[model samples]
Each structure stands twice: as structure tokens, then as C-alpha cells.
Target: MSSHSHHTIRQAILDRIQTGEWALGELIPGEAMLADEYGCARTTINRALQGLANDGVVIRKRKGGTRVCDMPVRQAKFNIPVVREQVEALGSVYRHQVTRRVEKAPPTAVQKRLGLAPGTKSLQLDTVHLADDRPFAFETRWVNTRAVPAILDAPLDEISANEWLVQTVPFSSGDVVFCAVNAGKDVAEALGAREGAAVFVIDRTTSLAGEFITTMQLYYREGYQLHSQL
Candidate 1:
């Protein structure tokens, strides 16, 4: 079989789980059985099941076999496209500016959200994304220096923190939240909009193997829409 066969097996298994064909807490067919069904090696089935286990979609035990999780911690698979790609996809020029970068104690709310210790120092970045010379989105991010020390030397002025992090850091799990908020003074000024204008916000926190990587909040100008597919 091709090296990529495991991905196909993974998707097939995920579809079965998601569609309820494999009920929660139900033991799936053994790896050997699945291999025979899929006409692939048992190792391919093992790899697929292991990936599902890592994503919290399945539980695997040496003697208990593999089963659908009773309460699956389903992770939303959102592909965070780079802001530059988003702008360029809209047939506009993409530009980004790093307005601020500092190392300081994060706010109490930020600390609580990220489960950080009090007085913990983090690298904070404020950036504005533009499309066709107009404000597209404003971003504020806090990065755990201990988790990603390379950011300390990376040039933020020439490259946006979002793009840089996407390229440099690898994450295994994350949480995403969406909301609507009124633009405050800082966000309003950065987006060239009046105060209290409605804006769409996307907040994301990412972790690498259970260690915090970064938390970012992206505030898009009015009329922005987020799209995703199952």
C-alpha cells in the first residue's frame, strides 16, 4: 500500500465514528479484521487508530481493544488560513503591520484564560492586517516564551506573528471561540472604524502536546464572515 493509505483509513474510521455507525463505547473491529476489510496491512490500521486516539476520538487499550469514546472530546478542525492568503483570495493586496511588541505581565483575564501563573511574563504582539490598503482585521496575541523561545529573535516587523507562528510552531490541540463585539477605542482606531461598530472576533488558544503555545484574538472589520466545512 502507499504511504498515504493510513490517512484514508483514518478518514474512513472518523466517518464511521462521526456518523454513529460505530456507537459510543462500542468496540470496533480488531485491527486485523479492519485490515482484512480494507485490504491493507494491520500496521496501517494500527496507525489510523492511534491517530484517532490522539485526537480523543477513540480509546485504545492493549487488552480491551479499540472503542469509540463514550464522551468524545471532539476537536473542531478549523484550518486557520493566513491573513495574507485570505486577503489575496479576495482579489486584494495583502499588507500587515506590527504595531506593538512587548514583554510584560499579562492581564489577569489573560492569565486566567491561559491558566498562567500570576506575574508570568509573555511576549505580546499587536498587529493590523490590511486588504487593498483598508483595514481587514486587528490582532492581539500572547505567546508563552517558554514554549516557543524562537519568537524572541524573530523579526515581527517584516513578517506577521500569525504567519511566523504558523510556520515555526507545531500544535497538537487547540480551542476556538467566535463572538460579536463592539469595537473599543484600540480596535476601532486600528480598523479605521467608529467606536461601537460591530466586529467579528475569533479567539484561539493552541497547545503542543499539552503545553501552551499561544493565544490569539483576531477582530475583523464589519462584514467579515468565517467559513468552514465538515
Candidate 2:
């Protein structure tokens, strides 16, 4: 409102979101309404709101409008996507490598998260997300065969489920959590880091059309950081 300060607008929007004054999935007021409330011009409100959406603090749709999220986890707020686009943002080449793939029974922990009964069939995919051939993330993903049964027979070495999902699937809801974990032998090898090193782990569960789709764990090297403005 006062010369379009990022700090001012971000705090105001965040206060509303945290206070539950704006519930998740509820459309935000239009720019005109916000301008009236904030005592600012429509341009200022537009700039403020646009910055919030870009920072993953809000979801903006052309006709659907902006809405608050159900699970407002800050780490889960942004979609990091593949490292290729990230590195390319700084003018670097993106690279990828598939380490392994196996169709096997889902682990007990994975089964519980997917709400699957014990001994459900699943496919495990291990991959290294790289930037300019340097390890960026160690990703171990489990695809629920019941959700996408054909994954069992597909050549996972050629394409990642993350890539495929962007094209074919639409998620209804998601559960995401982030934590710090020690890089064990498997994780070290995948991320090209030393064993026992500290890494950031992001676990994501995606649902499509109200049904469980897949659950994935993404591990990033120590230096990796999630950044945002507003």
C-alpha cells in the first residue's frame, strides 16, 4: 500500500492466512476489494497479491481466483520441479540419470501412507536428479500400482514418473512433509555425498481425483536451499 513494499504486503497476507481469516481453497477478494480494504490503488494491490502467489503463499487462477491452502506447510509451499530447469535458470545444462527400478511389494511404511492394505504391489524407482551432471537430488519414488497399474510394465529407465505425471495425471490433493535426515550409504551414493552427511528430505503424497496416486521422497544435498521472496 505504501509504495508497494514487499515486506508490508507479505506480512499482511501472511497474517490473514495464518489467522484462518482466509480459509484454504476460499477465493480471495478481487483487486478492487483489496485496494479498498488496504487503502491503496488497485495497482498496488495487484502487485502485492501477484508477489504472494509467485512466492507460493497463494494459488491464483485466472477465473477461479486465489485460494488458501489446506495444508499450509512452508516447505511444501513451492514446487521445486526438476533440477534441469533450476540450473537452466542460471544458464546451465540439466542432466538426469536413472539408477534402478524394481517392481516389488510396498514397504509397510509406504503402504500405510498410501492407505493400502498390507502386501500391496508397487514399483520402486531410484534416480539422481542432476544439474550439469552434478548430483542435485536423490529421489526414491514409489508408484502405487493400483493407481497407475500400467507402470509395472513400463520402462522407467527412459522416463521418470515425475515427468509422466505432469503430462497424464491430475492431483486432487497432496500431503507433503520436509525434514532433516542423515545421508546413509544409499543416499550418499545417489546424491554423491559422504555418508552421514546432513540432507533435506521432502516426502510427498499425491492424490488424483480423490484417490491416492503416488508417494515420493526427495533428498537434497546439504547446500541445497529453498528460497522465496514475499
Which has the greatest TM-score? 1
Q: Where does candidate 2 clash, by residue pair?
A: none
Best candidate according to lDDT: 1
Cα lDDT for residue 155, candidate 2: 57
Misplaced by over 4 Å in model 2 are 1-80, 153-155
lDDT of 2 by residue, 82-130 (tens): 5455667857676667777877788798888787888877778888877
Cα deviation of 153 in candidate 1 (Å)?
1.0
Candidate 1 TM-score, true structure as reference: 0.67
lDDT against the true structure, per candidate, is: 0.83, 0.70
The residue ranges of model 1 lying beyond 4 angstroms of the native Cα positions read 1-76
